[model samples]
Target chain A: MHTLREIEERARAAADKPAPYGSDLDLAAYIDEAPERSYVDSLEQLEELGEEELARAGVVKSGRQRSGSFVQIDGSVVHRKALEKGLEILSTREALEKYDWLWGYYWKAVAVDSDKYTAAVEMGPYEGYFMRALPGSRTIYPLQACLYIREPRFVQRVHNIIIAEEGSELHIITGCASEHRIQAGLHLGVSEFYVKKGARITFTMVHNWAEGMDVRPRSGIVVEEGGLFMSNYVVMEPVRSLQLYPTARLVGEGATARFHAILVAQPGSEMDVGSRVILSAPRCSAEIVSRAITKGGYIAARGHIRGEVGGVRAHLECRGLILDERGVIHAVPELEGRAEDVDMSHEAAVGKIAQEEVEYLMARGLSEEEAVSTIVRGFLNVKIEGLPPLLEREMRRMMELSEEKAL
Target chain B: MDTMRLGLGGGDLEEAREDKETVLRVEDLHVEVEGRRILHGVNLEIKCGETHVLFGPNGSGKTTLLMAVMGFPRYRVTRGRIFLGEEDITGLPPHERARRGIGIMFQRPPTVRGVSLAQIVALCSRDGVDVEGLAADLNLGDFLSRDVNHGFSGGEIKRSELLQLLAQDPRVVLLDEPESGVDMENLQLVGRAIRKLLQKDLRRRRTRCGLIITHTGYILDYVEADVGHVLCDGAIVCSGNPREQLEGIRRYGFEECARCTR
Candidate 1:
């Protein structure tokens, strides 16, 4: 129950966290001889998992070190990283946005305790988490995770593991947040998922961070025959800059996936998010909705859907609003089908509040500001309607907070 | 119709403290928009309860005159005095002017897609207003839950604006082309809404003022205008009793005299 070595190990592990190295490591294989699930209740268990996760993650790095690929990310050009099946994640220390040289202090960190996936009463740090899937192993009880950054940091990375048995169904929710006015930080993480035939996977992420934070989170989905993957990303913050592309590949016939993203950028923030689906199977379908609001800054969204198979049906939509004159919004929707029998389509629009419309509200006794806010909130009615109960409340709270800032 | 009154005699409003009305006074008013001149040395005055009609062709600065009074950022008064009673409103923002009892109805109501007509009316009602009765008067009872003018027909926009004016209880209700695109039934409903507004008391009882802007006299047959001014090229080209200018503009049109007066 108590071990000084475990505490020291966990401290050393947390101290030396680096960028995630493995996109392919099976945490399930290490389940044997590994610390018992009960040990997680003890620091010793944590020490072992953290150590094992770090070591296995090194194996992943060796795999990448074999490939002719190197990690290079910076301003303007967004990037992402993920673990296909492992416990190792990249973690970087906080660094200034202009300080690119300090990225080496980061370590890729992943939750190593897969046994706590269904533990109703979670202990220290494992309350919630991001997860990925293995090549052959699948999970039924989706794991929970969270990511939080308080100070300027380098390319911090995280990896997740989610495996569904041949016909298992799972739902996982990941949350990320930081207090307002906290020192600016960076979060660059990724999730790689594998869904077996007849399995269903739904991964939801809600992100709210303080200003000065720039995030580029990338995710990849590999769905087998009769599998399903639905992804929803809801961001409620005035993030300085964000570029994310959560992607899915329909590799087996009758597999389907859907991606939905909603982000509201207040007076001086920028947000960019999209979903890309590639149909590799003969009869797979994908649908995506990308919505952004630029009240004072900018948001650029680019979405693409490629129906490479003859019987695939895919739809992509990108819609956004610019609430102020100085605010900017850009949307790009693309669809490419190699087969004549496939169906694909996309649409986008951006605009400001109309004068006559404002007058109409003014005559009704609402002040110009109130009128504009009402109109804007109304415009998001459709997108908000599509959100789940928990996320919808969070979105509404974020809107109210932004309005308070305006006041 | 023996139905015009002036100023609400009260202690205070949530925004305006004193409700007594001495009407508007404009002297040597000069207004500009987007770095270009519009109103050129215009002077005018209105009695507390006078009904004024502004007549001019499109883009003759008729709308600009009203817009200038509303304090739109686009229009700047280079030299002028605009007073509500003795209070100078020239430097005030649009909302500030509104808080002081000046309300305007646009020719085209602003479209706010998810804001319900009823929700806004309740917001305007300010202090425990009877929204149900107000909706009934403007014939907007059926569309209570519908967003303000999002999918409203032409008639509905006009009448709904009237309902808001009544609920807001502004001392001066400036109607911009109130007769445009109004159907026969809505014309009656809109007129009746104005009539009720002109008579609605903020508390207990008080007379309300009405300023109707138009290029046609159809609104005159419904709401009586005490005086009328011909606004051309940003300045009032001519001024006279509503009975005189309404008929004069109709007979001679604003083209002949509106140019000469400026």
Candidate 2:
């Protein structure tokens, strides 16, 4: 394992390097300092953040149905709690001060020198959430976390760590958003997940950014023997530019991973998002699915699945819909099989809605506009497997709410 | 065969028939699809509490007439007008016509990838209808959550169409081919569903009407038709009892029907 000093040195060396995908943004354009926010004893004490704003980002104001809750505003941690037993929720800074062994997991799954965004998160003063489930413990309700940007022209950097121990199951819902009035801002987030042997984890994220905000998030995951990892991501509101490509590696035999994403780009917005999974052990499997819709902007939806050993299976699917004449959607799905007995495949489709489909709905008493909206709603609804019922309902509600604003 | 000419002229025919009783009237209708004329000067009428059957050979424009009456944009009504109870609906779009008590079932509907059958059924219903009960009656309760027309069997498709029509409860139901691809088992279900939709079980006070296109005339076993028209070259050449016309066509075939003056 590399020392913390060595990691810092590596991050500093790669601070000027650019990522391979997406347009480059100047880091100097955003300020690092903002007005510090005082910590709140409970979420109800948050007077500045409106209930409607929190609800739009899939955060319950009362925290009635969540096992735990975490709230961070700009660079400060406002609220953090763990309501259930066998669960730990704390700020990364606090967790590091409490446990010295956490340094082993830091920057282990994700390279600190991968790109400038990850490097910036390391080199800058940032605060994020750290959640963990004890061995053999299962959460009844998912934990909820909100990372909000409230300052204009400020860059909010965060790094999160999540872990599920052996025979344990954990579910998390993370909502990322900015203030309604803020037009120009930046968000850089780095997340690392570890699923131990015979463990399972499901992470669902909803993004409700402003029209002129730019976001860059880097995430990585590792699954051990007989473990499972599933991720569901949704972004429906407008953002000036957003780019993320999270990867998961199944390193133990019989491990599995699944990733599903729903993305919508409004006018003047640009998004480049993708997911990749690598199967390195025998009998491991992975699946990636994405649905992208462009109203009047540009979107690049991509997926990649690699099988490196025999007896492994993987599949990737990407579907895109262009709703406006000026809108553009590009789907890129890749599959690679390095072993003889490995099975991998990919399918991608990008086009406009069929005229016949529109007419068929019209014959059923729907106006042209109503039919189109219904179809769009159905297109955005992707049924994820093995998701908790509450999380599924919350995701649906968020999608419907955003559909009203975006469509 | 002698030509049985019922003088179907403009304005005079409307005057001759009871205007209140006529549910649908097509006056000298001509239709074009993709810039090619398919129907030329076709005249037909269906009254309240009556069902009409149309028979024609392959590519004889049997489906075109139903599509034109349903107000599909691609059917392209080039000449003449269509009236639903004295109100002209030639320029209205399909959804407007559907809202105005006109519903049609396609021969081969496209499969909608994510729209479920239950959703379409609910959309078609204007009032609170028992969707699950109706689907159960059609033996399609298990298919309610599935995508519309996705990988459905021929019989299942026919039953699904009937289910939608039942929910719609339109005043004039246009069925392109009700018995085209159904099997022995599902044919009875489809035929009975059509009977229920057209209100054929009632011997008196029946207000619903239907216009069905069939090649085999097998639907006659369940629902009785008041009139059967043989469309030859896009024009109705014969009009009489449905069973008699079916027997005549069976004996002489559509070639003889086209050659006959009637």
Candidate 3:
């Protein structure tokens, strides 16, 4: 019953959310000064601050890189090749910050009172931003970016890029959240993981947006030899609709990929999630795990882990826990093994909290609801132990953002 | 004279007013589960400050009787009434019964993950119980910050369950096989924890009453048992000295007691 700004003024503090640490990046104060990442017309006359400067300058190199060939089940080989082209997105800070939410899939807000648009936050270019990892120095520390769009606008678009040198390891975490109820928004973001041989990249994202928030994040990872890629995504929002699929192509020998996710949809939210892995090299391994929870809510999880090249083994596991009767969950884990010698398997489970389990705690004097809350918290906690203290704090901080309860 | 009708018409019987000290009294309790009959008219009573043992074979309605007493929904009492200090509680919900100062220690206990033991102990307390002091009593001073029961060993579970029951401050405590899967040392820990629950005076309050449902008599040796009943075939077929029944059954079996049935 309030305007977007007024509502944002009254909502619970982000501190109640789960992340273990707060970032120094002040969204309200970041100046639009020079564009974060934009192209220069003269490439030959630019001076840079080492690799960081090159990355910030949007100059990266990729060519004639042959990692190895992975033999498929049909005896065909997937030859590892260089990513032929480069992609860039440049925008002013205000233009990018206008759509703050990272996974806002849907929203609708017009001056906070002109009740005409019931738009859902859609991930696209408006919420879009660009970054070029400096050209030469291999990036070791990953960058963290976040978008928080309130109800005044439910639509958004985002584009991001990362370029790795011959040898570097980078980790990134991105998030999306809404500011107003029923804010219709959109998110369409592209992440180009241009990895040179022997570089490692890990991208982890956690979303706890409202039920109306919808998200679709697309990623492309081209891995060279001895490189690695990992994805950790934990989403606990029912109303915020979502569709995220990260693609990885292992181009180098010993290239590896792993994706782990936990989805919890409480009453009144809907989510559709998916992931895919393409192995084109021998000795390449990929693992995908999706944990989904639906309580009076809905979750559809689909994943594909394929072994296209010979000597490549991939594993996929998806587990879902539905707390109440009305809650629904659907999970499909697919394994496409092209090589007969490839080792691959997929498993998925969906279930509710056991009655005896509830009675067990009740006999000890705890209420049924309290028991379920504890169980749910513990089940997802297995992933919390692995997150960085700061990211963990941030993840926890976003958990309280669910309009249902105070943190 | 006792079996014959002896009171004025429409007048309540005076017997209910007499044994005011009897904290728990069950008469002719017939319980069923899933349309399958279980307990057949079982009668048992425990006076204040007394530890009563309900012994039985598996599926002997031991756990069923405990669940019914604890007011679990699945177990139905077809006939008879469970009286707690003259109050007829044959049709009360589990939480209602819990509020009325009744608690239990589950046989197959479920862990309370993510919720701190301290927090759980406070929420489950009928008398606003303190978690740390109770944990210390049961030698759980170090695990208070951890989640309830999750990842705990058998002994930790038993001890922690007792810690929770101690916090409840109930007049009658129902234990559903407290010694299952526990080792000898853990069994000792269980016995000690129960002893503390039975004897402690929290902030100067009345001691708790106990109803222990167990197959083994190890708990009996550690905690004093004022009355013992063997439940089998849906009823109490035998009742006598706790030690005598335990030792006698170990050597002579139920067939020996069947010969002397009512």
Chain A fold similarity by TM-score, each prediction: 0.62, 0.98, 0.63
TM-score quality measure for candidate 1: 0.64
Better of 2 and 3 by DockQ: 2
Report the lDDT tens digits of candidate 2 across residue range A66-157: 99999999999999999999999999999998989888889887899999999999999989999999999998898999999999999999
Per-candidate clashes, comma-separated? 46, 0, 89
Q: Which is superior by DockQ, 1 or 2? A: 2
Native interface contact recovery, all models:
0.54, 0.67, 0.43
Pitting candidate 1 against candidate 2, the one with the higher TM-score is: 2
DockQ score, prediction 3 = 0.26
- The root-mean-square deviation over C-alpha atoms between each candidate and the true structure, in angstroms, is 13.5, 2.9, 15.1
Candidate 2 local Cα displacement, residue A74, angstroms: 0.8
Alpha-carbon TM-score of each model against the true structure? 0.64, 0.96, 0.68
